[model samples]
Target: MQGKRVVVTGGTTGIGRAIVRSLASQGARVVTLGRDENALKDALDAMADLPGEVHGIAADLATREGVERLFAEADVRLGGVDALVSNAALGAEPIDEMADDDWRYVVEVNLVAAMAATRAALARLGKGGQIVIVGSISAEIHAPGESVYSATKAGLQGFAETLRKEVEERGLRVALVEPGTTGSDMQEASDDEQREEIAKARMLRAEDVAEAVDFILSRPPRVDVVTLRLEPRLQELP
Candidate 1:
């Protein structure tokens, strides 16, 4: 991975953060984005000793302008892009229970932003460039009370699958990583509850998903991992 240039959205915390660290450790130059300025600073500081260079951009993916700014900074920081990881997402309450604006913001962040980022990256990506979308198993399970969130994920599932076929002719690889019951800031479970579940092999850590991403990118140019689903050993489905 040495000297590879990559971009990762929503990379200041949770799974995205883990992916950034993993890539940096292997000497990949990465530009990552977050909505929080402090989190962006912290993420950059934390990677100071890694072999790879890391840059952080504070941008709100919920808006088109923010997405534009992110890629603009990426273009300046990395010069060119080799991989783009669309990992930013927002969890939402049930559609009926949420305020109209709130639900719409969730869609903007979780779904629309991904599409925008992918579009920008495709313009810059060349043959052998990788696009990895961090999706969720909720799209498949469709658990109750996750109407809005599930809808966005289901949209990503279709987006990633269809996009892969469209870009395969160009030698661009697209992969989707769907994780189930991950312990992240977006999780509703308390810290103790999450820890207990992790210990029981019923919940996955953010780093687990990061590793899956690294594996996908590490594959030979001839190999394309279309989709990889990761669930804890004891995770139960609705």
Candidate 2:
């Protein structure tokens, strides 16, 4: 990434932050987006020594308006985007006991927001661009009580497949990277014993997913890893 321009949404903390650091270290001009003002400032302060330029845009990624604003701002700040990582998403809310408000928020952020960003990114991203939609293993399994979340990821999988074909003519590549139970904000939301149990088993590190993104971006233009399912060694379904 000597001069590559990269954009990572939801990049203030957790997996998103890791991706920002990884790309910045490789000399990519990284622009991060998220709603956390303090966290983003803190992240940027901490990465003061990275090789590439680092910038942040604080915005609500749960709406189309915010996404459009982000892309427009990115155009002024970075000129054009060479790679995009759509990693921000609302977690799965248990469907049986889900609140109506939570359901709407879930769909807006997880599904609609991603769609909006992808649409905008396509316009700003030039030829030879790489788009990676971070997905989950839950997209494949019928996890009890995570209907909306699972469905959204499943939908992303399909969307990536379609986008890949549609944009191939312009040398654009789109792919899906699905990881199982990554070490992220979601892991911290659980208790120690529960986290340990999951970690000791097969939870992936967010850096690992970031590494996958790095690999996808580094590939030759003619080749694209269309889909990847990243699961840890200790994970086994009952």
Candidate 3:
């Protein structure tokens, strides 16, 4: 990944932070986008000692303007992006109880922003460039109370497939990663006892997913790991 210019969204925490660290350690020039300024600073500080370079930009992906700002920042920070990771997303409550505003917010971040970013990245990416959509296993599991999240991820999967086909002719690669039950802040949102039990079981670590992203980015131009599913052995099915 030496000198590779990459952009990662929602990269201030959790799985996204791990990916930024891993790639930067291996000589990639990574630019991370997040909505929180403090978290962005923390992410950069955490990676200060890494071998490669990392830069952060604060942008809320829920709006088209924010997505545009992210790419604009990438242009100035990295010159041109060789790869993009659409990792920003928000989970939603059950459809029946979800407010209209909340539903729109989730879709805007998870689906609309992802598509918009991909389009913008394509304009800068040349042959051999790659795009990885950080999706979720919820798309397959379809657990109750997560209908909106599941729908977004499932839609993202379909989007990736069509995108791969359209961009293959340009030598641009597209891949999707589906991670199950990662040990992130999301887990902390649950009750303390439930969170403790899940942690004790050694749920999939953020680093685990980061390693997968690293592998995908390191592959040869001709190779594309279209869909990679990462799940902890101890994680139960929904």
Candidate 4:
């Protein structure tokens, strides 16, 4: 893990932040990207004492322009990235209720942004480089009303599968880590029924997902842990 350079999108908060901290603690140089300037600053400040190098960049990831700016800065500062944890996603409204503006924003942020970031990182990633997409179980099973979010996550799952084949020859590894009910802010926007279902889980935490990432990345250079679907369930698979 010494001196590995990692890029984590959505790193100002939630699972993304946890991934940044874990990587930084493992002696990996980490660059965390988010749009919130204040939150980015807080993320940087919090990571200052880490043993590895830590930096933060604020860029709106929902647009092509924003992704371009992010990678340009990253090139100037990091030479190239060895790992990318693409976690930036917009969880949005029900299909019938979605405004056109909101629908566009959600798809652009949740799917396209991650693709652009992946393209940038893969451009320079050498052998042993890794990509982890922080996906959702929503990709596998859609709920009643989360059409936009579910569609984007399902798209991510498809993208990851194709990506693994495209990059494997170059020794680049890709994995989509789909987690069910992570203990994060995604549910704060949920209505009572949704929130109640999430609360019942013995739900997965951000760090739990981070550890799954750690496990994947820690594999030997020849090992690739692909398509991880982790859910916290002792009660039923029954």
Candidate with the greatest TM-score versus the true structure: 1
Against the true structure, candidate 2 has what lDDT? 0.83
Please, what is the whole-model Cα lDDT of each candidate in the order they appear? Answer: 0.94, 0.83, 0.89, 0.84
Q: Write the number of the candidate with greater lDDT, choosing between 2 and 3.
A: 3
Ordered by TM-score, highest first, the candidates read 1, 3, 2, 4
Q: Candidate 3, after superposition: displacement of residue 196 in Å?
A: 5.4
Candidate achieving higher TM-score, 1 or 2: 1
Q: TM-score for all predictions?
A: 0.98, 0.93, 0.94, 0.91
- Give RMSD to native, each candidate: 0.8, 1.9, 1.9, 3.0
lDDT for 98 (candidate 4): 85
lDDT per residue (tens digit) for residues 1-238 in model 3:
9999999998998889989999999999998889899999989998999998998888788778888888888899899999999998887888888889889789889998999999899999998999999999998998988889999999999999899999999989999999998877666455565557556764777888999999999998768899999887776776
Return the lDDT, model 2, position 37: 88
Best by lDDT: 1
Candidate 2 residue 130 C-alpha distance from true site, Å? 1.3
| Model 2, span 1-238: residue lDDT tens | 7778888888888888998999999999888888888998999998879998888878998976678777876787789998888988878667667788888787788777887888888988778888988888777985876798898888888888898899999889998998887777765446565467556866767788899888888899878899988887786553
Clashing pairs in 1: none
Instruction: State the TM-score for model 1.
Output: 0.98
Quote the lDDT for 105 in model 3.
Answer: 85
Q: How many backbone clashes does candidate 2 have?
A: 0
